[model samples]
Target: MSDQTLPKTPRDDDSVLAAEYVLGVLGAEERIALQARIDRDPDFARHVEAWENHLAGLNTAFDEVEPPAHLKDALERRLFTNIDSAPQAGLARIWNSVRFWRAGAFAATAALALLAIVTLREPPSPPATGETLLASLVTEQGNTRFVVLYDSSAQTLRASLVEGDTPAASDYELWFVPAASGGAPISLGLIGGEGEKAPHVPANLQGDFTDGATIAISLEPAGGSATGSPTGPVVAAAPVKKI
Candidate 1:
């Protein structure tokens, strides 16, 4: 979905943006862009505060561990050392030494690792309210299966099946069969005969919020939709979104 199609908020916008940011779910490029914007936009700081408070709530689950005494002293010493450093005099000359090349290589590797972490963090679970929708696909034998999908800040999409009812003797798996597709339907994951569980949606299905994609529950072997497509009868089906 396009940004123009998304709802723009006048209040709590900053808080909402910051909350998502702190969750570490924002894409690497998007986070960098927000950082640049924060430098010039004091108004955006409100959002940062909102994000901080949101994360602060999660801190209650953990007990604080005190740092080692030397560790604290070392940190303070390093902080003072950086503050006491003299400004560099004029333009620094580039060194042709092997040590300089080694340092440059190390810095580049560190940057690549940081980017990998930022981009590879797990996706957020769906929020309980707002534009999110929760549904269930029931088998023909009258078993209820649960699933959820949510729109990202980028208006992209993701889905997961948490729980479902399978026949006493058969296995049930979920598939995302695109209406215009020629290849196999993407197998989301397995479901249980009862209870709740959230499975990760396919990354490839992100941003495809059109009306054509169909969510179907297919009976497979004891494992799941192993063929990467639905091999059994689609007992339950629904569109990607309400039309």
Candidate 2:
């Protein structure tokens, strides 16, 4: 807290601070303070924008992941080894170098989420007779007029929309979210908001149709998301449960 103005010194730490912010490695207090600085300082704001642009391409590229067991310790050793509890002047040094404790912040932010991850057990397979699975897709307002039934043997869901409005030039896309943590959602093509339309599950996703997996309805363009992930608002969703 020695110098809030240190980041405004020059583009050296300023640009690195921008990268740290975009990477989301700052603490809650630091983030709020830095964001305020960006709002008032146009030059610093440009640095944030530049870093955002540099990291934008990574959004659709990197998949969700769990860090390795040694990741936390390794990052701590590399980044926090030189940090000290020196006088207030030393606090300025630590504050000025934003990247120094970035790994710590990143680790702190993710540890709770990582600890909350439930171990994914291999879900029981559906019987060959095809267990009937039902999911009532509802909007945020708790509208449940959209229902989908899954046929385990067929690897398809019969979607029947009793009520829902579809925007012109938009299609309702079905996605399969696996039970395992960090798994990406897999698109199961499109479904119509009308009587009994069977949406085919891709061969890869078909195996993951066990209970605990979830099915969601997202509104997309006429064709679908250009990116492999959901790019639009999720209108309704429900967990696939065997009846």
Candidate 3:
């Protein structure tokens, strides 16, 4: 896209630029660039907030309808069919999807409102060791399945499933892989299909959060890995990055 097509220059005269942003019309690159300005400019942030508040009213205009909690299986069968996960669908790819952006202004406003509601319900995480780090547990298909956030400020580790369906007869186990050349996987505990979890970081394991730490997820038995070590197929793993 042309650089001029994006709202790089946010000004009072171009206040509608905030509206376009709130409507999710900007591409990922454009969004990131505009976000940088929003972070540094207090007035611009307020301008964006005003747009969000104005757009949020659209959510109330229509009757609130909750989507079925477990629609992954059905949705995939219908949409994906013979396609194997439909490529990587990375942020950039999704941003460029015509069907996605074609949802237009009202649909985008509703989505933003829904996100706001979800964010409001998120409980605050306990402070960790003052340094923050995170790892995205991704599948071999290049899809991010879960995100593990290490809250050094709260001395806690939180994991949230970003994609994939919860197993009907099994559980997803979290594992920590040390940065050493040949480190064995250590079981952190089981995580749910959706939502966030603050798994118990054993006192012994607490000190093991190294700069090169990696997090892994495996499909395990109902409760968790029967053995202390991972005993199931490891589906995803990735090194943690500093926030």
Q: Which candidate leads the pack in lDDT? A: 2
Model 2, residue 187: C-alpha shift (Å): 0.5
State TM-scores per candidate. 0.35, 0.43, 0.45
Clash count, one per candidate = 2, 0, 11
Candidate 2 lDDT over residue span 42-138, tens digit each: 9999999999999899899878799898999886444322222222221111121233223323332343234334312436545468766666554
Q: Counting only residues 3 or more apart in sequence or on different chains, how many pairs clash (N, Cα, C under 3 Å) in candidate 3? A: 11
Top candidate, metric TM-score: 3
**Cα lDDT of model 3 by residue, 71-159, tens digit:** 87676344322222333322222122233222322232444456557856888556544776665554544443565666765766666
Give the TM-score ranking, best first: 3, 2, 1
Q: In model 1, state the lDDT of residue 113.
A: 53
Candidate 3 is scored at a TM of 0.45
Report the backbone clash tally of model 1: 2
In order, candidate lDDTs are 0.51, 0.62, 0.61
lDDT of 1 by residue, 121-208 (tens): 8575455443332333333333233343444333423333333334444465656666675856776665532222223455667555
Estimate candidate 3's RMSD in Å: 14.3
